[model samples]
Target: MPKVIFHKHGQVFEDEVKPETNLVVRAGIKQFPYPNLRYECGMGKCSKCACKVLAGAEHLPPPNWKEKKQLGERIDQGFRLACQIWLTHDIELCQEEITA
Candidate 1:
């Protein structure tokens, strides 16, 4: 298991998650301390789960086709679909910090 630190509202929601756990599942398991989390297809087609990867982007699994497509031209901006982010190590993530 890897610890995930989700930063929101200037606070951190830390939780231990399985390596294969995706952000949406983790969020749901821990309940939403984070935001902008919605699911329609649950297969990463919809971008409702879009999140900004403020840090630890390298600690997650590589982007899948669905995420790549949904993120489109924002991949370089650290935009990633939460449903597609598979945790690989302890990671710190934040949405608001993306623009900072």
Candidate 2:
């Protein structure tokens, strides 16, 4: 299993997850003990799942067409939709760091 680290509200939450786990699911599972994560849609439609790749961006799956379109102009800044990100390796993510 890989690990995901979420930084938000000036705090951090980490969780172990399978390789295929998306950010939305992992955030929800680990969010109970954290105050920063805000997950709205498990699917990729909502922008609430937006996060920044503080580190290990290469470990995540490449953005698909849907994610690219959803992220739109924000994609250039490393903003990724949580529901669209499938973890292939260890990663560190932060919502506040990326979201405008």
Which candidate's TM-score is highest? 2
lDDT per residue (tens digit) for residues 55-78 in model 1: 788877778898888888878788
**Stretches of candidate 2 above 4 Å error?**
27-36, 97-100
Per-prediction CA RMSD (Å): 3.8, 2.8
After superposition, candidate 1 runs with Cα above 4 Å error: 28-39, 96-100
- lDDT, each prediction: 0.70, 0.74
The TM-score values for the models, in the order shown, are: 0.73, 0.78
What is candidate 2's lDDT per residue for 1-100, written digit by digit as tens?
8777788878788877777776667457764323466778767777777888888887766787877878887777888887777777888887774435
Model 2 residue 27 CA deviation (Å) reads 4.5
Q: Candidate 1 local accuracy as lDDT?
A: 0.70
Cα deviation at 62, candidate 2, in Å, is 2.2
Error of 2 at 72 (Å): 1.5
